[model samples]
Target: MAEKLPALAFGELTDVVRFLMEIDKLKSIQRRTKVLGTDRQENTAEHSWHFAVAVMALAPYAGDQVDIFKVLKMAVIHDIVEIDAGDVLVYDLVARQAIHSEEEAAAIRLFGMLPDAQGKEFHHLWHEYEAGESAEAQFALMIDRLMPVLMNLHNQGQSWVENGIRLEQVLSRNAFIADVYPALWDHLKNHLDKAHQSGWLK
Candidate 1:
């Protein structure tokens, strides 16, 4: 005698499915940073995955002891806002600030697509990461800023050169990395200097 399967929960399943379908747009939402070692531009989905990968590899090097899992969660969900708000370039300070309010609104709508409990959990992580106050948030934020710096260094300052960005602009935008994660910041600075001297970074 075999057990019979239960009837599907269509309403609950429908909500979750909708949320999954909505987030799929992240794959198509492109960022300014290109894929390292590749000529192709990176999308928001790839950026989120790479940020999680960076967190996994660099967790032990965090400036302060942190909840690694929370940091990972933060990295994964932080950019879900890009689905509605879109990716803002690091150098676009005015535009970046302009989108802050819209991003907060988008966070509510996108995460709200999930079930109530799940949506709140996601919004919390997204908000925490934006605040960058806690140790985990600080470390997660550090990676967000560092990854683009590394990409430009490897790509002969691809985006910087394309956009005519200067060294002061790059350093000014990334100063928080040094303030929070000094060691990683030092490593970035050394590569940045090499990038500048090599004429890759202006």
Candidate 2:
């Protein structure tokens, strides 16, 4: 049986605690990317943390004009909506389009778990990232694409192979990197070429 608990206090912090507990749901949201060299796939919680770290580590590579803080914020919250919508691979064209409404609904419910002020802020940040209209969002999107590409390459194109994703699809999904961070795009293209030459890509 589960352990019995003591009485709890209900106060100003209750909403905050509730919000945090609700987000624990993110851990169960599995992503398409795997931990390199492992057969197992990653969950959204791990993806968010790793992406936040990557934002910090790669911020220097982003243009001098971008805000690192905003970029980091985008990385961590971009997939929080996936807790409901689940993950849809970028190459899955139809599902990607279908999930937009699902994700928006999810974002409304998930972020609304918090107090109004915080929830509004969370939703705004998520919307900004999704829009990719600002420099921070653009950089965040680049790293988001680049990280999975790196994972796929290191895993010998595991997901790419499983999904039968093609080189043109990858290039199209990742082309934005060339405009924002050419060096990062060059690095990603190198790995992609290696994957192609190794016959890891079909």
Candidate 3:
């Protein structure tokens, strides 16, 4: 007779399936943007993918030795909490203040869906991204801050103009990234200053 595996055996395969399904929900959480014209509605999945690619593209500028894979995972899971908190505009001061509590609650609920070990692992990754302590997390954040700026610039400040966003607000929102990725920040600031001068930024 074949030996039994165990009374309370849990298959890692099942845990993977559950995590995949939960991650799939990211495809439905749309962001507030009108990029690429026709009022583009980007979902969380797209945003995550964009950041992951950007992290690699900008990796050399990271402050310390960074594991590209960790940065990718960080980017992919960083905003999963936004599914519950909802997408808040970068320039919205009131919404930004409430984001912490709302996202913490959402993180508990969303991450709680996974098997114990898996949930804890992902929660740690998400928290690391938020803390911006690791080199990977810092790089991940730079991309996160850069994406909207790229969108606005590419679309000739379409979203910025619509949202009544000023250059000062955009600069302030991304200022933290300068602490780790000063080169990227410098590049962005140059573009932003030109954009402001040319009436491309409001």
Indicate the residue-level lDDT of 56 in model 1: 96
Best-to-worst order by lDDT is 2, 1, 3
Residues 1-202, candidate 2, lDDT per residue (tens digit)? 9999963556987877877777899999878778876878899889889899999998778878999998888888899898889999988989999999999999999889788998999999999999988998888998888888888877888889888888889998899999998877898888788888887776
lDDT of each residue in 30-128, candidate 3, tens digit only: 886653767668887888888888878877666458788888888878888877887888789888887889998888888887888878888999889
User: Compared to the true structure, candidate 3 yields what TM-score?
Assistant: 0.85
Q: Which candidate would rank higher by lDDT, 2 or 3?
A: 2
> Predictions ranked by TM-score, top down?
2, 1, 3
Pairs of colliding residues, candidate 2: none
Evaluated against the true structure, the overall lDDT of model 3 is 0.81
Clashes of each: 0, 0, 0
Clashing pairs in 1: none
Best by TM-score: 2
Per-model TM-score on C-alpha atoms: 0.90, 0.93, 0.85
